[model samples]
Structures are given as structure tokens and as C-alpha cells.
Target: AQSVTQLDSHVSVSEGTPVLLRCNYSSSYSPSLFWYVQHPNKGLQLLLKYTSAATLVKGINGFEAEFKKSETSFHLTKPSAHMSDAAEYFCVVSGSAGQFYFGTGTSLTVIP
Candidate 1:
């Protein structure tokens, strides 16, 4: 079984402050994790992925996350938040084949 739960459905942060998004997952096999950002009226883009690779993965737009198997979590973090970072993020869990499952989705609001 493979599943993921985002601790928050929405996160609000100031334009210059750091951003944190929590996610937890359960998988029977070694999981393939991904974080995708979706802007309004736009498609989803791959932020990063963990395919039994490095534990700490750096992504685009100053975003990064660490895969903790013991904690069963993969939390996203950013040094500073930007207005462009305001978007919907989905925590994806994919196994063999092209199967993809998305999280409930997190809406990030960047305040000025």
C-alpha cells in the first residue's frame, strides 16, 4: 500500500519569510516521491523527486526537502518565500509503472 497525507491543506506565509509544507506517507515498497507546483490556470510542474536516491533533494525556485524513512515524512522547505511561490502543491506518490496519486493539495498564500 502507498499513500500520502499533507498535514495542511493550506499554508500562508509572508513574501520574505520561509515556507514549510508537511507531508507523511506510507508505502509497502520503496516509494517514489514527488512535489509538483501548480499555478492558477496552469499545469503542474515537477519540483523534485526521490526515487530511492538522495535523501535530501534540492528543487527549483529555492525549494528543498528531505526524505525521512523512519519518520515516514517528506517535508518541503524554502529559505524565503516569494510571491511566485504562491501556488497549489501536490505531494505525489508513484510506484511501478506510471501510476500517480496526488495529495489533497496545499494552497500557498504569499502575503506582501
Candidate 2:
């Protein structure tokens, strides 16, 4: 079985501040991890993905995540927060069976 967990349901940050969205996962075997973001009234878009390639994966909008197998974590981070970055982020994990598990989601609030 595979599962995805987003530690924070909501996160607030001021403009120019660093952003961190924690995510942990569990799987019976090596799992593929992905981060998706949904802006207001917009469709979900892939932020990044980890598919057993480089441990450190970079995504759009200056976002990146490191796959730590020992810790079973793939936390997302950004050097700075922008007003446009405010949105709902989802952490997803997929198993070899082609089944995908999604986290509840984390709402990011960017304050000026």
C-alpha cells in the first residue's frame, strides 16, 4: 500500500520569505512522488516529480524537493514566496500498480 501525507493543511508566509511544505510518504516498494499546485479557479499542474532519478528534483516557480529515502520524505521548498504562489498544493504518491494516493492538500497564503 502507498500513502501520501501533507503535514500542514495551511501555511502562511510573507512576500520574499522562504516557503516550505512538508510531505511524507509510505509505500510497499519504490514509489514515485509528485507535487501539484492548483491556483484559484485553475486546474492542477505538476510542480515536480521524483521517479528514482536524481535525489534532488527542481520544479517550476523556483521550487525544489529532495527525495530522502532514509527519512521517507520529499519536502517541497522555495527560496521566496510570491503573491502568485498562493494556492493549494497537493502531495501525491504512486505505486507500481499504477494507483495514486493524494494528500488532503496544503493551502499556501502569501501575505504582502
Which is the leading candidate under TM-score? Answer: 2
| lDDT for each residue of candidate 2 in 1-112, tens digit (9 for 90 to 100) | 8999899999999999999999999998888999999998999999999978699999999999999999999999999999999999999999787888999999999999
Instruction: State the displacement of the C-alpha of residue 87, model 1, in Å, after optimal TM-score superposition.
Output: 0.4
Root-mean-square deviation (CA) per prediction = 1.0, 0.7
Mark the 10 consecutive residues where model 1 has the least summed lDDT: 94-103
If candidate 2 were superposed on the true structure by all CA atoms, what would the RMSD be? 0.7
Candidates' lDDT values, in order? 0.92, 0.95
Off by over 4 Å in 2: none
lDDT of 1 by residue, 1-112 (tens): 7888999999999999999999999888888999999999999999988867689999999899899999999999999999999999999998567688788999999999
TM-score, predicted candidate 2 vs. hidden true structure? 0.97
TM-scores of all predicted structures: 0.95, 0.97
lDDT of 2: 0.95
**lDDT value, residue 101 of candidate 1:** 76
User: Which residue runs does candidate 1 get wrong by more than 4 Å?
Assistant: none
